[model samples]
Target: MIKNANIGVVLVTFNRLEKLKKTLESYAEQTLYPQYIIVVNNASNDGTTDFLAEWENEASPYKRIVINLSHNLGGSGGYYAGEKEAIKLSASWIMVADDDAYPSADYIEGMDSFIQSYIGGRLAAVCGSVVEKGSYALWHRRFKRKGFSLEYSEVTRPEDYQKKDFEVSYISYVGPVMNKVALQEVGLVDKDFFIWNDDIEHMQRLGKYGKMFCVPRYELHHDVDSQNSALSWKSYYGLRNNLVLLKRYFPLRFLIVLSLLTAKAILCPLKGKCLQEMRLRLTAIKDGLVGNLGIHPVYKPGWSLKKSV
Candidate 1:
């Protein structure tokens, strides 16, 4: 571990108290613990606030800090808020994680070692491999090289990363370690995105300043299958934000590839699947056309309890 580096781990959560607890448990067992742990509670009504307070009171190793927002800020907002706090704390490196991802005991140690070795002044951010919890299948894949096209391919196990440091188009924010200096140079995640594609957008900006690396040896366990599942609003933002990203950074050839992919999604063969995809695509396009990128909040039934403990 880099003893000189003050690393802060930031976790963003909504109502997944149980998953957050699991993530914390894994963090508590880390071989190379962060200087501090910050949890951004996004207006959760599911006893999340009380649970955080309780966890803070009974912490084992790392310093526990919680910042409760008055309303839901979505993933992008939560990450931006956490990153801002991390910068305020003067952390050299900030590790961003989802509430459901659990890193192994040596995960941070591996990341620190990798960063110390390959990350000259040119390295801005480092991303780790994310493996599914149950099936152990690939969830997150390696990042595309600077001039390469973006593709979602399966990553193999035993998690050995490519050695050389290279410029990447984007890296997964699920378990990415960001350099504060780079963030200050490029700016934090775009709050306009609200959620989807925010990480990609941030990485794209950071690439202008320095290189982004993927440390596959440092792996995390994500409890969900990110590849297959797609929430309605997530799909909408993804399609819209991808368009925005493509328009901003992608080359003309890649733009054509993206358009083809979008067309395929809109014109899939199966009736049910095609209609659903088309609806999401159309809604996203409509929202983009009218400058309505923000999505309406959807609360679960009976979610407005006065107090949860």
Candidate 2:
């Protein structure tokens, strides 16, 4: 509806070609089409690159480009790569999505309308509501603090969301559209994060420029499982990165918080006998405190790391 709104989308994915295909289909089905779509593939070995090459050969309506990464640099690095491509494309506003988020037909229209709103001028980033495709449940989680530690217990809805926009401290990397102006002022995402806490750090930067909002009226189908996989090992990065963030940004509170978390790492597992909260978790805490980062080569037995495309 808005003329000459060159909305460029940056999609980051790895090893989820089927999900990526569905997302591409969903993007193609949008009522308001993007000017271009820049996909950042983090060296997927699942025929993802070949599949996208095939997509390019099809009679696709919108312009599409793919940036094939050399390594599995995780989501943050993937997003950083996409942001660079978006800037080069001279996008008016950049929309970001993970492979699993499937935007509705009016997704871009809603984003455009949100950007055209009165407070839109100050909105650094805007995100849409996401519902779990299988459970039909709200996707974001409600977090609470229990003195130096945090807990994720309840479902989070936009409490102040009337029929439209509402404030949010954080939003999942499901479907976030950011104003290029704000991005120019705030700068790009932290690639050092490599995955978790990258969005949080990026949002924290945006706060210095303007606020982030969620327009809960617009919805998307997010079909990923809510809980962590039983054999998953991503917790290493998640835990290490957040602790590293706290140490870097919250210097004065870091030691006390770290001490508390270290105690929790030792004492909590003893109480629950959880293997996930094992000695390896303490190793992560140590790794975070010492500032060691990047793709961890240490994987469990039975798993292999395909480092590149």
Regions of candidate 1 where Cα sits further than 4 Å from its true position: 1-5, 59-61, 134-139, 145-169, 225-231, 251-279, 289-291, 297-309
- Please, what are the lDDT tens digits per residue for candidate 1 over residues 1-309? 224335789999999999999999898778777888999999999999999988877845567789999987888889989988888886688999899999988878877877778736787878766777544334343445445344422344333345433334466778888888988988998876777778877877887888776666567888874453544456667667766666566656446756675676667545455455565566665454445655444322222212211
TM-score of 2: 0.84
- lDDT for position 185 in model 2: 86
- Please name the candidate that would achieve the greatest lDDT relative to the true structure: 2
User: How close is every model to the real structure, measured as TM-score?
Assistant: 0.79, 0.84
Q: Write the per-residue lDDT of candidate 2 for residues 1-309, one digit (tens) a residue.
A: 323345789999889888999999998888888888889989889999999887766776567898999987788889989998788777688998889889888898888877776454477778778778544344352222333322322345546444566666555567878878878887888786777778766766676777777777777788786674543356667778778777766665667767876887788656965655565568778888999877666732223222210
What is the RMSD of candidate 2? 4.5
Candidate 1: which pairs clash? none
Error of 1 at 105 (Å): 0.5
lDDT of 1 at 40: 96
